[model samples]
Target: MNFFGTIFSYIRETYVDRLSYFPSNIKISLMIILFCAIAIVELYIYIIFRRVIKANQNKQTKYWKERIGNMLASVVVYDESENTAEIAVHFYDKLKKLPLKNSTVNQILTSEIITYHKNFTGKIPEVLALLYAKLKLDKRSKKKIDSKHWETKIEGIREANEMGISEMAEEIIKYTDDENGLLRMEAQAAYLKLSNKDPFHFLDRAQERILDWHQLVLFEIITKNKKLTIPSFSKWLRSPNDTVVMFCLKLIDHFMQFDAAEEVQRLLKHHNTRIVKKSIEIIGKLELEELEKHMFEIYFDHTDEIKLEILNSLGKISSGKYADFLSSRIHSNDSKIKRAALYAIKRDADHGEARLLEIYHHTSPENQALITHVLDNRIKQ
Candidate 1:
């Protein structure tokens, strides 16, 4: 019996030992509860600590930003940008170096200065800002870049000068030796736009490179005062060069006397199609009486080219008397010349519409259709 009690006591102690240390079911439950409680406390503490750290960092950054902004007020004008102002001030104080470079930094600084002036709330400051921009654009420390570059920069300076931009014309003239015609032309146009003046008088020798459009505008300005400068007119009008002659023809047809018109008319007989077309254009611009004489003189001598030119001039002249002359062309064996005459007749054929209607009904279906189409298109417009 003592031996049985001893065995039972040994079994009970082993069971208790297992529960306390090695883990029975009850011990496993207790361990799991205790581990979950500790994990919950640790996670809560981590969250609180992270929030505290973020708040402290933000506070420190804000404090530093404000402090530097207050300090920068001594040297530069303070505007909005509260945070950036603080940071910029701190960067300036910590570094002995400036925020901008000597060459390009002035540009940055100039824009900043303009902003500062604008923030001050007055036109005076705005004007000063403009002057600042002009000053920085013009102050060339070295001439490493070509004249074109300098001229372009100088153009900005002159532009800021407004009515005074003409002074920059002298600077632009310095670049005339430039091989680049485009740059030279830009300078010429810029000079014209700025000064409300003409450089063409001075550019007489350089007119070969002057484009037609630019020359026309500049010509208008130079002649704006009605100062009667005939020598320039003669050089432009009688020049053997086609472009110059075309420009002259355009100007003279619009503004010159009949004498100039007569000159272009004489050149129509010249072999060049250019001169012929130009004269046809001039005839459109002339009075009907003036046109009748010229068209009559050229009428009988009809090369296919001259025939077309006369037809074009007659359409512009539009006299009923010539409707008969044109009617004869309808009978011509040349189909194109007949069609051309039909167009002229259809245009001036007020009393002759009966003749056209008669011709339409009697003529071939193709001729009838062609004439009918031309009449429809012309009359509808």
Candidate 2:
């Protein structure tokens, strides 16, 4: 045993001596320096990510505040436009249909975050009109923006020369900031093709930072003024921020854009399940049956928020193919989702009454009242 112990000690010492030759002190110092450098890089990356996220969030918040103010004003205007007491009631109904799920301020913020930066045209008119609509509306005394990009806009204003194309340019400049979406789109059409065709030319350079402009411009180009809105809007649906995609779904209100169904399907592969569920829900909002398959998938997800959204949307729209999935969610362990399922079934459907009644009698009093509300709505319908 002693001999074996001596041999082991000798081997250990030999290993230690070999290790010592590696300059242990220098190695330790190098390791410490490397660790610190890695830590610094990690910290720098964190700070950058935080700053970007904060900036994005801040912009959204600002837009939200602007939207709430505009919506409130629009609501008031709508009330006065109506000659009767029903104006207030109609205005409330319209407000209810709006995509806003939170306070008007927060809803605007949420929409802005998902809203394309290039699409500022939609919101720009909101800001400009509000600024001029009422003195009470003017909060910022900031400098007014130049209506024209530069002297080209001024020179184009020489319609007396009969320069037809130049006159068109002038028309665009004049209405680029107009409250009307059609006019704004006309302005975008006057420039987009020509600008991209000869990108290096001065005419294109005039709108060099166009992509950075508020998405009101993009939306005008993509939606109201023309047919260009879908592909661009579809691109945004797969964006990193789910909020951006959410608003994209909201803006895409037309039936033709509903053909972009496949793009929304691509969103099911999104890393965030909330975003995936929202994409499907938006399809559901558009009354598209294609969203049913994804609805089934989202219904099975463990997330409460995603499940609730699916339940709500599926209950409203999923009729033929996705009904079974919606039925299964009624049996979900989650009381909220189950209650929502019962409510949706009761309102838009009658087949689920037996299941709903089973829960109505068996579930708690609060749940029973909710189920009763659904049944009452069904009776009224």
Candidate 3:
């Protein structure tokens, strides 16, 4: 019995010692199973916690937005001169009682106030601006400008500009060089909005490419002034950055800055196709009749698109030998070139009808159809 008991003890110690005698592969598999079970439970708990937090935040936002909306409506909807004093006192007392520590609520209130300003302009915007000052929202927005995240900083810049916080202009200008394109664009626009004395100071030094959409936004803002100190875009025509030069050319043409005509003629010889195209557009629009010879000289050295544009520009300058020049292209195989040449002939040349008839008699059926279409369109017009 003692021997049997000793053997039983040895067996228990060697094989039944809580999985110690298991194969290595089985031991590792068991560990992995145990780890997966724990991880699944933890992930399940985390998901529940997130859902609870989101729901609580939604409730808090709803409560705060309601309280702030009523206060804002009173200030925006009330008459500026008469009811403002009573509303101001009521608003301040209520605002002081409300908890301003909730950043979500602050953002909600800021958006509501900005919405009021966006929709209405006169005395209401002024009232909202005063209310914004009284609530000290500007401090909150200004704080976001220094945030580590680029999007947060851009939002702060936007809110600052929307509220007419003129002091933020210099701070906003610092972001114009941000590597992110959207951030740079928003910062530049905000700079223009906040800086009244020098609204265009950013454009003057901006070496970045001003895209077409960016130009449209800037143009709309600059033209809104009842009495604007319009700067001479000629200053930027010589900028080494081609995009800046292109933007200045567009501004000059849109604003009809005729003084830049001499500077514009110089860009016709520029190597960039886009710049040359825009220069041609400006010349055509402004009727710069003196550059006809230069236009003809550059015609053969450019693409078909540029050639078509040259014909269009030549059509605008009727005083020179552009008619005889266009006559040479009337037989080109490229249909667009031939069409443009015909259009230029009719518009620029005095004996263009005789030229069209002569071409029709000797040309192919396709060419005859093109000339006949041009003549018919002229009579219809």
Candidate whose TM-score is highest? 3
TM-score for each predicted model, relative to the true structure: 0.48, 0.39, 0.82
**Residues 1-381 of candidate 1: C-alpha lDDT, one tens digit per residue:** 699999878756755655577647766776686688789999999999999999987775566445433433332443434454453444344422433334344444443444444455533343333444344333431121223365545434333333233445555554433456555555555454444344544344344545676667656754573543433343455555555566666666656446665566566665666556666666755644465666657666647766766776676667766776776776677777777777766666465466677777777777777678656754541
C-alpha lDDT (0 to 100) for residue 240 of candidate 2? 52
lDDT of 2 by residue, 212-298 (tens): 244454445445544232243575555554545654665654434776688887776677675676676676677666666666764
lDDT of candidate model 2 versus the reference: 0.51
For every candidate, C-alpha RMSD to the true structure in Å: 18.3, 23.1, 6.1
Better of 2 and 3 by TM-score: 3
Q: How many pairs collide in each candidate, listed in order?
A: 0, 17, 0
Put down candidate 3 lDDT per residue, 55-91, tens digits, no spaces. 9999988988887888788777777665544566656
Q: Cα deviation in Å at residue 159, candidate 3?
A: 0.9
Descending-TM-score candidate ranking = 3, 1, 2
Please name the candidate that would achieve the greatest lDDT relative to the true structure.
3
lDDT of 1 at 199: 50
Question: In model 2, which regions exceed 4 Å deviation?
Answer: 1-213, 216-248, 272-274, 320-335, 350-355, 358-366, 378-381
